[model samples]
Structures are given as structure tokens and as C-alpha cells.
Target: MKKFRFALALALTAFVPQGFAQDVQPIDGIAAIVDEDVILQSELDRAVRNITTQYGDRADQLPPVPVLRRQVLERLILVQLQTARAKSTGVRVGEEEIDAALAAIARQNNLTPDQLRQQLAADGLSFSEFRASLSDELAIQRLRQRFAQSSIVVSDGEVDAALANQASGTQYQLANILVALPNGATPEQIATAQDKIDGIKALLDRGEMDFQAAAVRYSDGPNALEGGDLGWRSADEIPSAFTNVVGGMQAGQVIGPVRGPSGFQLLQLRDMRDAAGSGASQNVTQYQASHILVRGDDAAAKARIDALRARVGAGEDFAAVARDGSDDTVTSGQGGDLGWFVHEAFGPQFGDQVSALQDGEVSAPFRSQAGWHIVQRTGTRQTDVGAENRRNQMREMIGQRKLEDEWNRFLREMRSEAYIDIRPAAGVAGVTDGS
Candidate 1:
């Protein structure tokens, strides 16, 4: 279950690559293949472009393609898988559901849905695509909750383990100024953005504007209206690129006119804390988990799961297989990788799988909500992989490693059973569902 933590996803934070200087041939990389469908390079690139265009302005740093490829694969696969599962479960997302999700997005960013769309449009994207994407995301979210409600088992022993195993980590709080860049933005346009950020830095230096007010006025991040309060988070929670900027800052210090493919970013460290392992210390506990998805034709999906697990057992690359086959489009490209999970947090099948796995072990294929999964144990840490931290390390190993795979299988089945077909053609104005 190490790789089964579906509930905790890396939120939408990424930097898009520089668009080709001239309109290049339509991207044609074969990122991966899943059964009959293949993930084209263009699709992966576009998704990254979408995330980056909107987040570049706020990100302090962005990773290179090869480095980010796995992550990209994971996310896209999850999206596709979940969308498919939603359809299978007879989960229909109408205009209202789409509207509510959009409203939630707006509220998250402190804007009206119309305003968010206007802003996105200004940046170059179909408001419809965003709506469509949100629907799939929500469907999976609900599916997981339902699974947890019915099957997740938490015990006092698990809680005690969590608290005992929790470790100290560093945390940061910051204010950000994000400037989203549309896909196909030119160098001149990007430079203009950087210069604008420089001006903001100057203004802050001169006490001309405060961080929060500026974020409210100019940042293109989700928390813009809330002054870009990302809340206290651990270093691991942030993009590795920003580690330096966040690491060196003093409270109230403004940092960055950082350059990114999407745009320029400015940041202000508002506060700091050392109690970063709070989740492990306070909230986590062991649970029994089992899941049922409302997605695909269970029989067909199960067949695929059998094939995938077989491949993994035969020494096939788990990440590659996941990227290529997992129905959870959101994270499939990420090689079906889940960052961390606890054993008790996963489904019963997943937990059982974890109990039987050894470090670096890969499981036979399993089915759950999304589709198929070839679960793997990349590595393990018994707290610190040492006797001194054995209890804590074991808990972490249980949570992050053992639970991840099961969670993935659960999600994959859910999404796999879902029925979906992309029009790839036309949509109702401002509506993505083709409704």
C-alpha cells in the first residue's frame, strides 16, 4: 500500500516548458500506451502547458521535462481513468455539477467563476476544458470518500503508531505573486512579465505595496484573493525548485522575480514553523480499506488488471506500465506512482497486498475504481531505515509505501469502469460536457 495514497495529490503547481520558438510540428512523442488508447506527447505537453501557464507566475522554479515526465504521466492517466470510471458508474456530471465545481475553483482563488474564466481566457484556454477536467476530478474524489466510508478501518493502535512515528520537519508560509502565461507565449512576452515582477519587487522594496495586496491585485495563483497564503507546508510539499528560495528566507522577506516558462514569480515569506510533521503526529491512523467503483464493465477491466499485474511481476517497469495502462489518468503518467501512504489508509486488498510485500517488491495486477495497476515497492524506510527510528520509520513505510499501490488499484478500477468518449470536436459554448 505504499503507493496507494490517492487522496493526497500534489495540487496543481507546475511550470510549463518554453513553447517551441516557431510553431513546431504537432507534438508526436509516444508518452505511453494504455491498452487500445495511447497517450500522445501532445496531450501530455498540453496538460503541462495548461498547469504551467496558470502556475508559472507563482512558481519559484520548474523541473525539466525528463524529470517531470513521470509526474505528468501519473496525473494524465489518473484523469483519463477517473473520467472513464465516472461514466461507468452512471455518474452524470451535468451543467450544474460543472457549475458548482467551477464555483469552487473560483472560491479557492477568491474570484467569481466568470472572473476565473475571463482570466483563463485572457491567458488562452477553453473555459470548457477546465469544467470538463473538474468533473472528472470530483467524481474520483467522491469515489474515494465512498470507499473510505465503507471499508477504511482505523484503530487506536494505528493512531498511536502515527503519533509515535511522526518526525520533525521544516515548514514555511509565504505570499506569492503569480503571473500565468498562455501557451505559445513568446520570449518577449515572458520578458515583459519578468520586468513587471521586477517592478513589483521594487515597489515592495520602496514600501509602495504590501505583499498580500499585490497578490490580490496581480498574482494569478489559486490563493490570489487570499493574498497567496499557501498555508504552512513542509519542504517536501513544495516543488524542489523552490527549496532554495523558501529555505533562505526570513519572515516578512520578499523573494524572487523568478523566471519560469509560464511567467515570473514573486514571493514573500510571511511566517515559518518547525512543526511540519503535524499530519503524521496528529491525524494519521491505521484503517481497513476496501473499495467499489462506479466505473467500467467490471469483467473487461479485470482482464486488463490481470494483464498489467502479470507484466509487473515479470519485471516490467511499474511506473511505465502505470503511465501506459492505469485508468487513473491524473497520475498514470506519473508511472502510477503515489508519493506516500499508510497501510491502514488503503483498501483491504491493498492493505493485504502491503502485508505480503517486501522492499522493492512489485505486485501482480489488481483492480479497483480506476482500472488496472502493477503495484511496486520502490523502497522502504522503517522510520529512518534504522532501529533508532524503527517505529516511526515502520509507520511511514506502512503509510507511504504499502498503501500507495492498493490505493492506486482501487482508483484505477473505479476509473476503468467509467465510460467516456472525448468529442475532440465541438462543445456547447462555455460548456464542456457537450450537453
Candidate 2:
């Protein structure tokens, strides 16, 4: 997926010269209106061009231009609806947050922010446009998270079934390309999709194209932009249709053109691993630690932390120093005791520093997102592998599956409820049934 992002950058770069050659103004109008929000024809045209560029040589394999335009317009409507909904619910993202996300994307491409801007310009994309798109993406994400938390529920039976499957111990890192067949499609459509997938498989067999590239070009799955990456999953987590087939495949091997409810799917086994005890286990190290936090203006905070570290190093009791100097009111009176915690409980910065310490070792002052801190590791113990942890993991897995389903349904319902009016030039008047 990281590689795919870089590919996206390169693909956009190719559009620069052509974009510059074209007239600055072309006819543009409304594509669709979602409640108070509107999708612009210009935006739809750009999206179609992007999809074409991403697909490269395989662009011809896509649906008819009119069908593709409608599909893109529908997606835009969904996005506008979600963004509108987010604002109504008071979901907000700060400019700082968007900048941070852009910085991360730059870092992924090994470029500085300025360099990333230059790259975007070279790709014919204005920084402001890119930032606006990213902000909308983040807003949609926040909206989905809010909905998922309230709507998703996992049953005990689901957890038990998940655990039973986990007991098989095998897990796979898989990538897939799907050629989707619409519901109640005629035999001709099915045969055409099959033929398309067969051609894809033949290309894979001949090593004409890599899996990631092919997925970006041809996959109909939601993760197509991420090269159809499904991440790592245990057998039970996989869709039932591909479970047995993937179990029998080897790493770096491609399988399928397998028929399933949604469509014909081609899968590649990227890698695999085994969980402990022929089943899932959650045995992990837990830390008991304490910290002294100091917050002031930057220089003052640094000075105070330095002084506190010196005092503790000079044989002052850590608990005494923490009680006297720490800023965390809840833990300061308790001598900064954080109680027992798993590594993830405190996030990477705190967890990593604590993990590096031996029992009774005090760490050098470090800064986290919160502020400066000097931590003392008092003890460590391994958590027991048990049914409780397994059940918790199972619940999370089940919840994620339910979340995806519900989110899709939610989008469909939103589209159905919206008063959408697609203009004639947009070329998609009657095709979108909230699918």
C-alpha cells in the first residue's frame, strides 16, 4: 500500500504537461447535488482522469465511459453526503491535523513537505486542492468511526466461532483483485467478467504485470487504490469462499478467479505466519511504572525536567520527587504510580522507553505528544494467555466486520434519502439506485 502511494505520485506527475497544454477554462457545471452540498463536473472529470491514469494500459478494460462517469459521480455524492453529515454532527478536524497528515504522506515518500509540494505541482495538483481533498477524507473517516462505535455489536457466539477458527493457527497476508458482477446480472455479463479475470490470471502466470500494479488497474474491490491489500488475517477472518483455497497455497503464489457472492476474485498469498499453541494467544509483557511530568513554557519545562532528573539521580527518592514535582495531578499524589499496563496502553513513546528499562531503572527525560517526562520502571510480568484476552480479540475482529457492513449500508441509505439531481451532461440520470 505504501508503494501504491508512491505509484500514485508518479502517475499524477504524468498529467502535469498535458494539464498545462490544455486551456485553463473548460465548460463546468453541477454533476449532482447532495442536500446542501454539490458535486462539480470539474471534480468528476478530474476523478475520471485519475482513474484512467491509475489504470494505465488497462483503461480499456473499464466499463463504458458513461457508466464510469456515473460510478465516479455516485462516489462523489457519497463523499459529499458524509462530509455534510460530519459537519452537522459537529465533527471537526483542525488545520494542524491536516498538515500532520500531509507531512506523514511526505515522509512515506521520503520527501520533505516543500519537496512534496514541488512534486504535487509537478503533478499539476495545487497544494490547496490536495489539502482540501485530504481534509474531506479525514472528515469521512471520523464520521465512519463515530457511526461504527454506536452501531456495531458482536455476539458471544461470533466470538466463539472466531476462536474455533483461530485454533487452526494459520494466518495469511493476502492481496486480491476482484472483477465484480452486479446482482442479478445476465449470463453474458458473468461470462465477460470471467473472461476478464481469466486474462488477468494469464498475465500473472506469464509475469507480465506485478500483483500490486494489476490490482490498482483492474480490481473492483474497495482497497484497489491500496493494491487490494487485505492485510493479515486468520482463516476465520477470511471470507469463507477463499479460506480453503488460500490455506492450500504457498507464499508469493497467486490463486483464483474463484466465484463468490460478490464476484470473481483473484488472490495472491503475500505471506503467512502461525500463532502460538495451534491457536491464538495473547501472552504479553505488562509494565508497572511511574513518571514525573513537568509542563511549562518550552524552555522552563526543559529546565524543570532536567533539574528533576538530576535530583532523582542524586539519590532523591523517585516517589518523593514525583510527589513534589510532577504535573499529573491524578498520579502525582500517588507518587506517579500508573499501575500495571500493556505496552499499547500508553502508546509507543512511553511503551518503548519503559520496555528498554531494566527493573528499577529510571529513564532519561523524553518528550511525548503530551509533554516532557522522566519514567521509572519498577517491575515487569507476563500476562497469562487466557480465554478472556482471546474473547476480547475475537470481539474486536467481529466488530470490525460488522462495522464494514453497516458502514456500506449506511452510505446506501444516505444516498437513497438524499435529493440527488444529476444533470444531463453528467450522463448518469437513472443509473444510481444507491448501490
Candidate 3:
């Protein structure tokens, strides 16, 4: 029955054609060139159509089609460049991994994989196209991970500073407008960008234009169409350039023409909240758990794990099983006694499974970064609000902030360094350069 369902999904996907792949293909050409790769006009058309489908009701808030086309084209070029770089660096994602990712996405949306394919067909997207897009996204994520791992490092001093500022607790819901300057901009070009930002600030100051309206018209940042909304971010979450300035502003106030690495930035303080009293405060759950680790490859290991799981399921002692069959020396002799530790002390995969188990409940065998194992949740406790725990949490938060900032800067630098050429589309002005 499962095989039949899988075959039926493939059949549906094969029979359903993409809108652009009809009997008569639309006249298509190159939209942009990134290093050795090309972005096709049809791809751009499809992306624009998808965006329109997503935000059609807010059409007035979107930039003009020509401008939107240029922005989307630039984004495509970046993706192509990143994918190529990832491939060059030997980053690979397997079919099994992609399948797992797809299954996870399906579960998130309350649908099966077959239902997901059918929904994509109904929306005029091919399942193959969807998979390919997912693959590219995953590849880009892997590439970013590699870059972040190599480049970002957090220090104790930075963590101390972050904790010191934690008392402020002020988080800003911000909207931004960026008049972006070209990479390696000349003095005159910098001045021109500044003048453009000043004009935008003037209009915003007099209430002639609202923040969203101004953003849609003039912001160069990617979220311009979404009213340049940065959503709710704490001071630590934001880039340093705007941190000092945002602290002084009140809700509904617009302030900027501030110089940044990218260009001139206009910030509107949409709202503010106290993070200390909010849900963002430092708090965590610690779990007391233990597992029997069976290390071997493929079928043999899986069979051993299956038998062990059955033994435990049939009321055999887990500790006895660990002592006899477990490969981990540290815990096997102690009957798999892992002392109380924060969930994050283990990796996310292990942490997630451990968190889901109730006290005194045993999980079915599951695979983690280490190996396949069954985890027993002996107990759980909430961490108290102690100075040491707070300091540890602050250090983690600061490290995350640094990583995010570094990632953004890395992308900017990547775009600047890549060799790209934008070809003009008929009836649309070409994007000659990126900001």
C-alpha cells in the first residue's frame, strides 16, 4: 500500500506540468550571470509569479515590477554563486537526507508527502522543481554553516558586556529603509546615497509618508516589500550600528540617515518591550537521562539495536542491557547513568528526544549524531535563576548574536567578491551591480 501511494505520487508529478513548461514555451533568455552559471528569464518569471501569488493582496506595498524583477534577479544570482561555491568545497546532501527534510516539511504542514506533491501541482509547481529548490536551500545552509564554523568566535569579555546590558531589557520592533551604496563606492556616490536617505528621512519626519510606504518606495534591503519590518529583536540581536541609536528612540519615532557598512539606514521604532520580564528571559529545563550506545555499521548494528529495544520493551532491565550490550565505556559500567545536565549539553537531536520523554519513560531506539540508542528519562528539573546559570545563558546569547552578525557580513562580502553580470530583460532595466 505504501509503495502504491509512492507510485501514485510520482505519476501525478509526472503528469502535471509547470505553468512555464506548457506546449508552447514562453520566449526565455538569460536574466543574469553569476561566475560560471546563468539565471534564466523563465525562472525569474516564475519567482515573480510566486511572490505575486503570496502577496497579491498587498500589491500596493510591493515595488514596481521592474524593480522587483531586478531584486529577485540579484537574489537568484547570489543563490547560484553560493551553490557553486558549496559544490566546489565538496558539500553534498544525499537523497535520504532530502527525503527526510521533505517528510519533516510535510509533517509541519499537516500533510503526507503524496498530499504535499498534489498541493504543489494544484499551485502550478512541479514536485521536481520543489525538490530542486529544497536541495539548493539545504546546500546554501550547509555552506553558511561551514563559513560560520570557521570564522565566528565568542570571548568571555563580550559575554560579560552582554550580561551587563541585560538589565536594559528593551527590545525594539523596528522597520528600516536603506538607501544602499555600491560596493567600493566613490566619495561622490556615498554623498548621493546620503542625500537620498536624507530626503526619505525628511518625508518620514513630516508624516508625509509612513514607514512601510517609505520602505516600499525607497529601501534597498530585502524586506522592503514586507514594510522593511525587522520584527521584534532585542538590542543584542541587532547589528551594532543601530544599537546605540535604537536605545534612545520611542515607539512611532523614525530616526536615521545613519551611516552603516552597507549604506545609509533609516530606522523606525515601531514598538518596545521589556525582555527581562518577557518570555525571552534566561530559563531552561535540565534532564536526567541515560542511553545504551551500540556502535556498528548498517544492518548488523540495526539488528542488534532492534533486539535490545525488544528486550527492554518486554520488561528487561535497561541498566542490565546497557552493561552487557552498550559500547560506551563511560556509562555502561554505571548502568548508563548520565548525571543531570541541560538539554543543550547534548546536541539538538538528542536534546529534542530527551525533552519529549516523560519522567521514568523509555524512548524507542532512535539515531543521533553519535549512534543509535534508546534513552530513558529518569527525571527532569527546571534550572533555578541563579547567577551562574544566568551568566551561562548570557554567554550563549552573545555567541548567537555574534554568529548572526558574522553570517550577514559574510553574505555581503560574498556578493561583493563574486563576478556577476546582469543582462537586460525586454521592457525592464538591467541590474548592473549589487549594493
**What are the models' TM-scores?**
0.35, 0.70, 0.76
Model 3, position 46, has a per-residue lDDT of 66
lDDT of 1 by residue, 1-435 (tens): 000111224323332222211123475555555444555666666555554454447532333443334445545556556555556667665777667666766777777877877776665555566555556666766665555555555454864654563444666786678775545568987777777788778878999777876775556554554566767655534433465567778899977777554356777788887763433423332322122221264778777777766666677766776766666655666765665566654567666665566667665556554444445665444332233243554344344432333454465454345432322321111112211
Which regions of candidate 2 fall more than 4 Å away from where they truly are? 1-27, 165-167, 170-235, 238-284, 296-298, 310-317, 329-334, 341-358, 364-370, 384-392, 429-435
Against the reference, the lDDT scores of all candidates come to 0.55, 0.76, 0.73
* Number of the top-ranking candidate, with lDDT as the measure: 2
Model 2: ten consecutive residues of lowest lDDT: 9-18
Error of 3 at 159 (Å): 1.0
lDDT tens digits, residue span 214-235, model 2 = 8866777666656779899877
Give the Å error, residue 202, model 2: 19
Candidate 3 runs further than 4 Å off: 1-27, 278-289, 293-324, 327-393, 426-430, 433-435
lDDT of 3 by residue, 1-435 (tens): 011122111122111112323232464887767777767777677666655655658777666889777666656666677788889999998898789778877776778989977776665555676677567667777887787679777778887777776657677898889887766789999988888899988888787888897887678886676678888887777767777778888799877678877678988889998766442435568899889888865888889888888989999998999888898899999888898988778788888889999998998888875778888999988876466765676666666667766765666778888877676762244355432
Best by TM-score: 3
Query: lDDT score, residue 285, model 1?
Result: 27
TM-score for candidate 2, residues paired by index: 0.70
Error of 3 at 81 (Å): 1.6
lDDT accuracy of residue 52 in candidate 2: 73
